[model samples]
Target: MKIDWKNKLTSRKFISAVTGVTIAVLAIFNVDNLTTEKVTALVSAIGLLAAYIVGEGYVDANRDK
Candidate 1:
């Protein structure tokens, strides 16, 4: 099956997670304290982004019957 990059980029989950990760990255990189909450948040944000990307890839790959 052919994958649609545009569709993946426009995916809700993909966009949401990537945005969250981008914010977290910005905050963590700029913040002075890397507290437990900050670390947990960063991990969650990155995890969400990864999961969405993988999900989008999977859906795209299996779009054809």
Candidate 2:
């Protein structure tokens, strides 16, 4: 089946997945600029993004009912 790349690119889940993967790769590289504090901040930011995604999904589901 053909996938809709444009729709996927505009999706929150897809954006999150890409962001998470990029973060993981950065952690793996142990970049000199990404210190402990920076990593902690990044984790917190990702957590907020995830929470927003879940909350938005919940709201959308409820609205559909």
TM-score of each: 0.45, 0.47
Write down the lDDT of every candidate, Cα atoms only.
0.67, 0.67
Residue 29 displacement (Å), model 2: 16
Please write out the lDDT profile of model 2 over residues 1-65, one tens digit for every residue.
99976456546677667666766777788866546457656766765666677768768989989
What's the CA error at residue 4 for candidate 2, in Å?
31
Candidate achieving the largest TM-score: 2
Residue-by-residue lDDT tens digits, candidate 1, 1-65: 99987666656667566656766776777754456457656656665676677787778989974
Q: Please give the range of 10 consecutive residues that has the lowest summed lDDT in model 2.
A: 31-40
| Candidate 1: pairs in clash | none
Model 1 weakest lDDT span, ten residues long: 31-40
lDDT of 1 at 49: 71
